[model samples]
Target: SADIIWQHCTVVLISPASALCETFNIKMPPNINVLRGSCVTIPCSFDVESRFEKYLDHTCKAYWSDSPSFTSGNAKVKPTKDMTGDLTKKDCTTTFNNTRLLPGKKYYLRLECKNDLKYTFKQASVNISVIGTLTCSAPAPCWSHPPALTWIPNRGQSQETLQENQDKTKVKTSVMNFTASHLHHGNKISCTAVYQKNRGSPDVTAETSLTPDISYSPKNVTVSVSPSGPVPENSNVSLTCSSNANPAVRNYTWYRADGDQEALIGTGQSFIVTVSKVKSTFFCKATNALGCERSRNLQIDFQCNETQEGQRLPQRFKTINEEESSKPKSTTQLLRIS
Candidate 1:
């Protein structure tokens, strides 16, 4: 399910060519979101003149440029070999190492045919921007599917071309999906486009990142008691409540339930009390930003008849009437003594 959800992507395709010779089209997302230290797959596709179809030996070359024409001094090129698959086909998708991209820079895609004609399309190019080095707050939410827990890709993968829109525009796309865990929280994810002008020249890239928004409620709520088992009457007892949560629980409360109603007894993670009652039942509530959870009820009995020396006392103590009648030299006590 995570894999299926992670495979989701929103693609926008370039408008179809009005003329047969004007067959160059680049389809990609206007912007990309990525995590830091991760690789990015740029979905790309193109078409060429029918005449060039005969030149199977000719391969399509991809590049990035700061200028629209890609003739600027800062232009970076990616050779045909680095491209994901045979660029002579309709798909020209590529993968870029995000580490090579600089943040806050805008780049454009340039396509060229390596042949005697030296065909290069400058009339239309796609713009790419590199944003964020760490933590993306808002990632694109999936509309067709729920959010997925996945990891970034480490190696390059194959490309998939799908038809988009009512006109069935062929769009090339690459997917990188993995299982997401707590370790990925607050980390950056980036999608980068890599380009190189020549074998000896330096490579250039564009990328962006996002901080994942993970949400969960309190869980594993539990209550622990100190000096466990059969508490002595009037002795001090301690109770601690604990739970796990994403935002961290901010408040903890203790409650006592006797009969008809439950009453709040204390606040915080620890509750201390003098055990005077014969029996008592308590539970704790842990609250966080997401939600709250209550622990299971804990019952304690404080009627143990053990002496300081750990010996059991007699079951019967002086009755109320017997102790009152024998207290002083009252008439009844005097007559009984006489």
Candidate 2:
């Protein structure tokens, strides 16, 4: 007998009375925010205890719901999406690409981490809001810098380094160009200004609101190389920038190719541009008070200078051999009496 053992060996398992482990563990921060028509990621960390054994497929299942009060009149609950569970790493998080949000609206989001097997959730809820200007690329600026003006650096609206004029005014000049689509209606387009107030100042903003009444698409643009072809070099090669427009064209800009630098040959609708140097290529740009037209790159060439070739007569003025035999008496010409 082994120390008076019991008649039959009995097995008993003991577990801590207070240690009833919960299902999935979750933790999140407060005051998280998201923007409308944008995406949001909810961070979560979890340690799956042995309790979540049944729901194998639901391991990846995630649930999201909006506030019930938001849909008081509607039968359906608020906006929700599933499969947000970013279970990639040991620290699982959730993300949502929310497009259902309206401008200046508030939304509450809740995610339910449900185990399909246990039909229970380790869930969390958060309240987020939408603010800030609803900005997309504004109408590609309907403006351009004429040649007379100095060229500023090519800067976009977002990265513009603003500078103030001598009068302490903002140089809010933006020379950009792009086609306008139907989405441009009623949109608040902005201009970058040195003065913060000028950014929102009615004077600084282009209130005309790109309408069809304006020259939305360049129209009635007529380009001509005056005197047509064989327009001699070192002479006036006129270029006319004519347009049938409402506002009418106030200025003209001429662009020439194959020059050492970008050259503005002339201004005005009818440009009397003299060709001094060898003409490689020629193009004229026309613009009104509204905007500048795209460049018309033309091809042109120059003829050799006829005056440069051959010798000239001496200062003594040598007589021609043919003139000697045909000499005749010179008579006095009648003068006009006015």
Candidate 3:
């Protein structure tokens, strides 16, 4: 039922004179998703009632029907040259070509022998869907050293299978379950297949890739002020807002926080403002088509006349005697301010 291989052949256990047609079944995958242009091989095997065992022969034919009715005359895919499994052995495994045109619908298998063995397995059906998925497959011509598959960036849960094609060739498939997010947008995921040779021959490798399209809101929004250090009161400074986003950020709105309320200052990526308070808090909002995000509060320090650099300069000055010794009788005026 899952992506794993089905080995055992199951029987329908139906009687000729009974109404047990619902018991008709087969062993195969329940669901399969493949690329549009690629082909797929369904591993199938089945068994009939013991009474009809004598009717099974090499002349038996396998037909894949789109409908469950036995008399619908709907033999859309008759695996004549591509039927790999031997009907005499009850293995109905088949391969269909030009799968790009196949409809995305469920399919049933119909078995018809030369004598009297005829039945449509309606209970066991396989649904096929064509789309782009994280399933990668490669041919394994040489089983001695089968190809090894590895995913680039090596993430997500994956399962692997070794299946047989119509020509009796082997194929190795790897299906990975991955979740898409903004963190991985624009990143390329690749699947590489490595094949090694025996007699010192060079190795062969094949690879395929997929890129996911992801859209997200703004992130890591922040506001930075020009002339970052402390500035004198009423000094002019520039504030800029920056953020990361897809489709680019549309606009930026600047906000200044006062005591308990916020005031809208301006718009655009950059804004010029005057520092009128001893300390001020500022932030910005970045918006795009998807959504918007607010930045953290940025505190700007303003230098005051008496408590900052203006008043500390005089107290740190050297005394008149100390300044004279260092200057060595230089003719510099030692004017002292009150």
Question: What is candidate 1's TM-score against the reference?
Answer: 0.34
Question: Candidate 2, residues 99-197: lDDT per residue as tens digits?
Answer: 433221123322233443322222443333222221112222212321111112212222222335466543332343222221222233333222112
What are the per-residue Cα lDDT tens digits for candidate 1 across 1-338? 01121232221212121222246555555455555446566666666667766654545466665345444234654534664546667565666664334332234655555554234455444443222112111122233321222224332233332324455432223454333333333444444433334568765433443444333346567887776655456777788887765567899999997985789999999999777645677888888765566787777654457778899743221111111111111121100000
Model 2 — TM-score against the truth?
0.26
| Structural similarity to truth (TM-score) of each candidate | 0.34, 0.26, 0.48
Clashes of each: 18, 1, 0
User: What lDDT does candidate 2 reach at residue 53?
Assistant: 38
Give, for candidate 1, the lowest lDDT window spanning 10 residues: 329-338
lDDT of each: 0.49, 0.36, 0.62
Order the numbered candidates by TM-score, best leading: 3, 1, 2
Model 3 lDDT per residue over 190-222, tens place: 778888877788877877665554445676787
Root-mean-square deviation (CA) per prediction: 32.5, 35.4, 27.5
Cα error of candidate 1 at position 21, Å: 69
Report how far residue 302 has shifted in candidate 1, in Å: 3.0
> What is the lDDT, from 0 to 100, of the residue 301 in candidate 3?
56
